[model samples]
Target: MKLTLDFYTRPQCNLCDEAYHLLQLFQDDWGFELSVRDISTNDTWTEEYGLRIPVLKYKDLLIDEGQFDLDIIRKRLHDLSSEN
Candidate 1:
């Protein structure tokens, strides 16, 4: 089963841009489907993540937020892959 990575972000966010670039770089290596969600388009999403743009989630599990930590996400992905 391919994992779906949900990226919650909004426009004009520098951190989101950086996180997105990193996610793109990791996409091929991790083999996960990327789903970009513009929080501004959804009220619920905006409310939940208004202060937490650039959030990364694998299913319901949050991988990272804000500036994003590559090492933490990498470890989580490694662990998740091992479980499959």
Candidate 2:
């Protein structure tokens, strides 16, 4: 199964940088393709997630704003693994 991390980001956003850095730590371990969507150039994404530069999305679920919990992410990944 391919897990997509829908990263909604703008140019030079510090939080986006930090979030991507954190996500990189587990990229190899998780073994999933990383897709970056620049909301700056995309109107729909920009309008929906304008101020929320860094957002984590998986399937139909969106992680709550201000909630980048690694433990929770780990658990979700583990669950996904078991499902596979």
Candidate 3:
């Protein structure tokens, strides 16, 4: 099955770039899809998630991911798959 992930990112953020890249790699290897949004352009989103770029959302709920990495991504995906 295909899972939907909302990726919040910015243009020049290295961290965001890395997170997006990792997301792409994981999406290719695993069975999922990504929807990226640039929160910097949206005022409300910028205010709420300015510092928290590269946020991932599922089921309209934001994941509390403090740091981004491969193991963390894998774990989150695994955990989410158990919900259904």
Candidate 4:
């Protein structure tokens, strides 16, 4: 099954933009569906990720936040794929 990658972010955020671009670069190769969410649109999301925009999640598991570490996410994805 294809995994879904949830990206929590808000507008006018440089870090978020950079993370988004990075995600897009490997999205196809990573073989996961990217679901981008604007935290500003949801109260709960806003409260949960207001300070941590550009959060990356796979299901309930948080993959990365803030500036986003590619190595961490790559390792996690590799581990997750191995499980299946």
Candidate 5:
């Protein structure tokens, strides 16, 4: 089985950029599919996320928000993948 994640972000956000980079860095190791969405592109997303950019989601599960450690995300992804 393969794990997939939704990475919610917006333009000109440094944190979002960092999160994207971190995900890309671990893509091979974690072997997961990533779908990046810019909240600013949609009205619903803009209202829903607002200032809470860079939210990571695995299906209905919330993985993390705001600033997070790369290792922490990796561990969480590992755990989630293991359950599959």
Candidate 6:
């Protein structure tokens, strides 16, 4: 089973960049699909998530946002994988 991740982000955000990099590292380890969504490109996204950039979603469920923890993410990976 392949896990898909939604990463919400926007331009000129260092935290967004960091989250992207962290997700890349996680993808390498867990082999998941990552989709990046730039809030700046959409009005709805920009309005709702403007201040909450770098949010991560897994199957419509929010997993985390900003300052991701390797240990917590690793645990989430383990938990999600076992569901399959």
Candidate maximizing lDDT? 4
The TM-score, computed over Cα atoms with residue i paired to residue i, of candidate 2 is: 0.80
For candidate 2, write residues 1-84 as lDDT tens digits.
Answer: 757667677788888888788888888787555688899888898898888768877666674333367887777766766776
lDDT of 4 by residue, 1-84 (tens): 768889999999999999999888998888777899999999999999999888999889999999888899999988888887
Write model 1 residue lDDT over 1-84, tens digit each, in one string: 767889999999999998899889988888787899999999999999999898999888999999888899989888888888
Q: Give candidate 2's root-mean-square deviation (CA, Å).
A: 2.0
Best by TM-score: 4
What are the per-model C-alpha RMSD values against the true structure?
Answer: 1.0, 2.0, 1.8, 0.9, 1.3, 1.4
**Candidate 1: residue 43 Cα off by (Å):** 0.5
> How many steric clashes between backbone atoms does each model show?
0, 0, 0, 0, 0, 0
What is each predicted model's overall lDDT from 0 to 1? 0.90, 0.74, 0.77, 0.91, 0.86, 0.82
Model 1 CA deviation exceeding 4 Å by range: none
- For model 4, give the 10-residue run with minimal summed lDDT: 25-34
Candidate 3, which ten residues in sequence have the lowest lDDT sum?
A: 63-72
Q: After superposition, how far is residue 20 of candidate 4 from its true place, in Å?
A: 0.4
CA-RMSD of model 3 = 1.8
CA displacement after TM-score superposition, residue 39 of candidate 2 (Å): 0.5
Q: Which scores better on TM-score, 3 or 5?
A: 5
Error of 4 at 36 (Å): 0.5
Candidate 2 vs 5: which has more lDDT: 5
